[model samples]
Target: MPKSKFNVGDKVRLNKRAPGYYGHLLQRTRTIISIFYDDEKQGNTYELGARGRGGSLGFFRSYMLSGVSPAQASKIGRPKTKRSYKRR
Candidate 1:
C-alpha cells in the first residue's frame, strides 16, 4: 500500500493548480482529520476540517492537497472578485 502524503492533525491546503471543481477551496486551509486507503486508486484519501467549523469538509486525494504550517493555515481570506464592464 502507498503511504499517505499527509497524516492526521496536519494542516493542508488545496493545491492552487489542482484540476477539477475545487474553486471554492482555492485559498482556504484545513486540517487533516482522517486518512483512508483506496485500493482502486492505490493511494490515500484525506478528510479535512476547518478551524472554528464543525464537521469535515470532505475527502480529497493526496495529490489535491499540499502541506502547510499552522501560521500559514490560520491566515484565511477570500479570493478577490473580478469586475465586469459593459461593452462599448
Candidate 2:
C-alpha cells in the first residue's frame, strides 16, 4: 500500500523480533534482492541476500523474518551469480 524503505542493491542486517528465529544464520551484510507483499501477514517482504564461499545465503524465504536494517559496506564476493528471481 505504501512505498518500501529499501531498494534492490541496498545492504542490510536482519532484525529478529521474536526469539529462536535464525534467519539463515546470517551475521554479515545482505543485499536486498527484491520486495513484495504477502496478503496473509499484511506486511512487505524484504528479501535479503549475500554471497558465500560455497554458494550463497538468504535464498530461502520465511514468514517469520520480520525485517532488515542498514549494514556496513563489505565485499560482495564472486562478482556474479547464476541465481535470479522474478515476480509471478
TM-scores, one per candidate: 0.68, 0.48
lDDT of 2 at 29: 63
Best by TM-score: 1
Residue 8, candidate 2: Cα error in Å is 1.3
Candidate 2 stretches greater than 4 Å from native: 16-26, 52-88
User: How does model 2 fare in lDDT?
Assistant: 0.56
What's the distance in Å from true for residue 86, model 1? 61
- Residue by residue across 1-88, what tens digits does model 2's lDDT show? 4566666666665555423456456455666677777677666666655454533354323443433554468777765756789999
Model 1 residue pairs with clashes: none
Model 1 scores a C-alpha lDDT of 0.80
- Scored against the true structure, residue 82 in model 1 reaches a CA lDDT of 55
Q: Give the Cα error of residue 84 in candidate 1, in Å.
A: 51
